[model samples]
Target: MTSKIKGLKHIIYDLSRINEWWLISAGFVLFAFLPYTFMHHGRVLDIEMFRILFTDPAVYIALLIVFSAQIFLFASNDYFDRDVDALDPGKRVRNPVCDGRVTLAGVRALLIVTAIIPLIASLYFGLLAFLFSALAMFIFYYYTAPPLRFKNKVFLDVLSHGLFVNTFPYFFCLVALMDFTVGTVFLLFAIMMRSTMAQMLQEIRDYHIDSQVEKNTVVVLGQKRAIWVVFSVYIVLFTVTTCLMLSYELFGWGIPMYYSIILILAISYIPIFRKLLKAKDYNREIERLWMGQGRTNRWQVAQYFASFSIYFILVIFLIITGYS
Candidate 1:
């Protein structure tokens, strides 16, 4: 019995790390709160909007599906990339599966279970939700699958990750609300751009392993050029997104508070931009310096927090302005 219990505990730990359950949970919260926050503005704790946000069955169900989809995708990635992950110098120590604590079969089983839940939810949600969910799964599969394994295709690899991982979830949320406006699409595009650039930066960090595997944008573009490309992409995304928000605010299409939120995000990128500019080389040591692994982790945490906070604030504003 004790042996069985130990096995169970190990399974749970493996699941937690492989599926990155915490990160998926964070993504779900971010998705659930984006519309709620925008509708309520900054006052997330308000009773009226809060009640509406929580009580809506469709919204809640959609969020659950999104969360499940993300979990499934994460697990599937770990299962497929176990070998590559074992080769990753920076991630080996932290990877649960790489350490052999979790069998690939266990991860595959978890993926199936996670995938089923979202699939059922999507079927009930409507065609748009179902379509996006299916697309998300397809993207994940193709990202790791052979023949068209886009994850190993340089620029397309980063693009696929950004679109499927970040923008798709955001789109799922909007689709749930039945808000398929051009503005929403443009917003998703901006998100895709930002996410792609961020992934590119991560590729720069993983340049060595990527080169070994011959599987990423940084490997194909070369480290120096890839870093510059990431910087350029960030600048363009920031500029375009800012202009769009300003136009929306000026035309009375969106609340001015979104502008403030965008400004905050822009400020958040300052350190990353500075590091890119000052970094002297693209080798391991230089990569370590610019990657600022600790700083990157902190920045990511901050970005997630900012994303939720901005959405919450926007929702409150929307409620006050009677947009809700």
Candidate 2:
């Protein structure tokens, strides 16, 4: 009983990356279901329609698959990066394997179980979604695993992270809700660009220690150039998203009138835009972003909320303002 209790504790403990995994969960819900709401917007005539969205069996299945993906992402990363993680006080304390809260074989078993759940849940969607989930599972598994470890490779590091971390999940959800089209492809491109920026920024944040052992893309390019890469990717993402919004508006893609609010919010990031692109001292700015406990952290939180709140608030608004 005691051993089993400890095992359960470690499994639950390692999955406690709520600040992160929850964001991915939100992304899954928005990307998977938003198109459904838009296409069937007229169905919002009743509060029960909105309630049905939450109560639908598919939502639970997608949540199961996404949560499994997150478990694989964090656990595999921690299992493989245990040595590198031990170098950072923050990561070291949070890592179950490094902290001796989870065993190597136990993590392996956990990974197996997590993968199985996604495989089972995705089949309910369709063959295409199942395939998407499979590829996502493969990417998440091999991302930090040996031999084909995409996380340690130059360029491929960010590319693979871009695919599975964000693009794949969104695409997987897209497969379930809508017929794949050119518009969906464009959206995938925007997501991939944003994911690349995020992965590189994380690498930049860990440059101090990652440089020692993890020869990732950022380590190869060096932190200065890596930040530039992040900035450049952000520009591409911003441009693509702007174009997407424009297309939706012009082509009558069924987006709401308030969608312009999202563009305005994106514009609001101009201050950080100048901070990253026009900063006189990159080192100090990066340090404050990752290490400082002041405005930097608050800035990140603001960015997070700004980027995501539109989808979140829209979900509620759609539910309430249903043509009902």
Best candidate according to TM-score = 2
Per residue, candidate 1 scores C-alpha lDDT tens digits across 1-324 of 986676556555544442434455555446545555555556454567666666767766776776777666666666667777788665765555677766677777777787788778987768877777888888877787677878789778897988877566667777666765555566667678776876787677777777787677788888788878878877887777677667766786642454345457766777757866677654443345334452244455666587668777885777678752
In terms of lDDT, model 2 sits at: 0.72
List the candidates' TM-scores in order.
0.80, 0.81
lDDT score, candidate 1? 0.67
Best model number under lDDT: 2
Runs in model 2 deviating more than 4 A are 1-7, 41-45, 181-186, 247-265, 277-297, 306-324
Off by over 4 Å in 1: 1-46, 249-255, 281-296, 299-324
Model 1: how far is 32 from its true place, Å? Answer: 5.8
For 67-131, candidate 2 gives per-residue lDDT tens digits of 77788888888899899889988778767899888889888888889889988888898887888
Among all windows of 10 consecutive residues in model 2, the one with the lowest summed lDDT is 287-296
The positional error of residue 7 in candidate 1, measured at the CA in angstroms, is: 4.7
Superposed Cα RMSD, model 1: 4.3
lDDT, residue 27, candidate 2: 66
After best superposition, candidate 1 residue 16: deviation in angstroms?
A: 4.8
